[model samples]
Target: MTLLDFDSDRLAEFATQVRGDYEELKAKNLKLDLTRGKPSSEQLDVGEALLALPGEGDHKDADGADVRNYGNLKGIRDIRELWADVLGINPEYLVAGDASSLNIMFDLVSWSYAFGNNDSERAWKDEEKVRWICPVPGYDRHFTISEHFGFEMVSVPMLDDGPDLAAIRELVQDPQVKGMWAVPTFGNPTGITFSEEVCRELASMETAAPDFRIVWDNAYAVHTLTDEFPPIHDVVAFAEEAGNPNRFWAMSSTSKITLAGAGVSFFNSSKANLDWYLATAGVRGIGPNKVNQLAHARYFGDAEGVRAVMRKHAGSLAPKFTRVQEIMRERLGEYEVARWTEPEGGYFISLDVIDGTASRVVELAKEAGIALTGAGSSFPLKDDPNNRNIRLAPSLPPVEELEVAMDGVATCVLLAAVEKLGA
Candidate 1:
């Protein structure tokens, strides 16, 4: 059969059998991992200069602020400008800080519970029970922070259109609901960006709680796996116009940009939110790692620097991502038995196995020396109500190994799908 067999039943069947053979082979091969959305070692090379850091060459900001001091707690000056440009928010609204943006998120929640923002005089902990809406197939760490704080967690459904807005609107009308975890760009696990309508609606929303906030985490703003990634600026501005300009607390970091652990994080919001965060966080420490923040600013002076670095990352990642999709299309595409996301920019592609077979597929992968992120990790408390979604993080594996490993995954999914259908 020709290579471009769009309708070649023979090629299709052959692909299916190849999957079975690979799974059989995997049952005998050495160990491997294709679960975490971590950048490969080769991918890490682009930001190597960041590791050496503020060498003797560079030393100050645009305003003569020293890079080696402890008082720039809000963040380094130029990088604040850089973060503003990078995150598409005003520089005044941004808080340049320590490396982990997620850490900042955790801290914000802690602050809200322990000490309410300036607008609200009461600590959230004094309330009967605070609540948070967690979009399903969401970041586990987001859910953990809520659970850690003893906040009631509500699981909101997510589809291609983003978190079901109708449910979100209704849920937020309750005064007890405090915030929602959002990754508007290239959302983790499911490469879903919110639809423009949903975003605008979220911004225009009148919540039940005056102190409510949107934990707007835009972690994968530039990592596009497909051409479908749209810049959702329309919806992002709702917080400002909705009268509660501080409604969205946005955070991003260069951790995934330059290096995972050592990169700097930017926190953006309205004037009120910034004043609130700074007032509480001001008591805790000096400034963030300005040295690293400045290093990133120097390494990537503008959008061009960020884009150039991302393109290099995409080059290293594309082949691996493409291979996984190709295998899935070849082996599981025809079955009507399983479905997977065709992601545009995020690190993960969520796979939905036959109704009751996800755990089995993961178990099969595990027995053969591959460790899938535990089956339910994409959900809160590692619980996927349907036990159907599996996240594929293709960036971490080499092409050759990924090809073989993905084939095995396809085989497991197919076997599980077919077995259930037969029963």
Candidate 2:
């Protein structure tokens, strides 16, 4: 039965039992972590072949540019063409970079704030007030970037298919609303891919801000937990067709597919936007690590080779995701005190507990020696109005450790829910 059906007496008894469970959990003194969505060691082993790639004397790119020396600020063609095909963008439009796409994202915003983008009438720093649209239960790092820029972050609901387009359309009516953040494919924690209709609307929608941009962080484009990768829509093409050619700054990476810390990153946009990026990027450094880029190209000979690597990732990851869902159902199903997303791809499972109790759940779990992503971390400024959401990262730990940690988490959830209800 659901907790709501319980009388005061039964509720008290249940709370006592859950308290006992919590005590036993604390007694175990377990040190388990579910805080970050890092790839497991086994998953990393899948890409061990990358370590020895591009053997000696393989420094020249397809264009015969010596990769060891610096010159191509736009990145080597070999890696760009490979990931361009994977991300469904033209090779010319894609710029391959170093390990972290997050760094590239930060640079984009930083440059725009200081010098503005190709279409900006004035640098963002000159604006009286800058604002950004952040979809709720989204990536914390994205919110961190927005917050760091001192932009007034406005939260919009992330629906099943995509961010609420109607709200976005309304928000864009204000010229200060410069852009929005989107993880179009297998989004960070939600695992929801934007539908074609949503993509069309976002690309074509009218905005008062002439320089409106979308940070399309497709981080998990191929990090699927299923057999087939989802179709990646060409949002840039949509924007071009809709007369908003500079609307999107799309990005992806090999971070999750291969080595998380040592992988190539990609950026794709209109020619004007790319030129703008290159102009500033040129001053920032001589060029990206082209030798590393060439190594990646050699690692994944073609697009299919990339998919083959992803299939290995799926093989290792799918079971962990499945086990998390199974444990959640087995433990929390009857209580009906929580619900969570069952994602087909992506590294997180978004868990929502009883209203006003998420923080308590996190606290209880911490006391029991389990670490969870902080309560309300999925929202901007570390705030969740209802205090009801928690992001669960099951990717880091092994299946056995994950199962144990999840069980402890389930106990914590029940204890927190009961305490909240009884009080």
lDDT of 2 by residue, 128-151 (tens): 989999998899999999999999
What local lDDT does model 2 show for residue 201? Answer: 97
What's the alpha carbon RMSD for model 1?
Answer: 4.2
Candidate 1 residues lying further than 4 Å off, grouped into runs, are: 1-23, 226-229, 232-236
- Alpha carbon lDDT of residue 40, candidate 1? 86
Write out the backbone clash pairs for model 2. none
- Model 2 scores worst on lDDT over the 10 consecutive residues at 414-423
In candidate 1, residue 74 scores what lDDT? 80
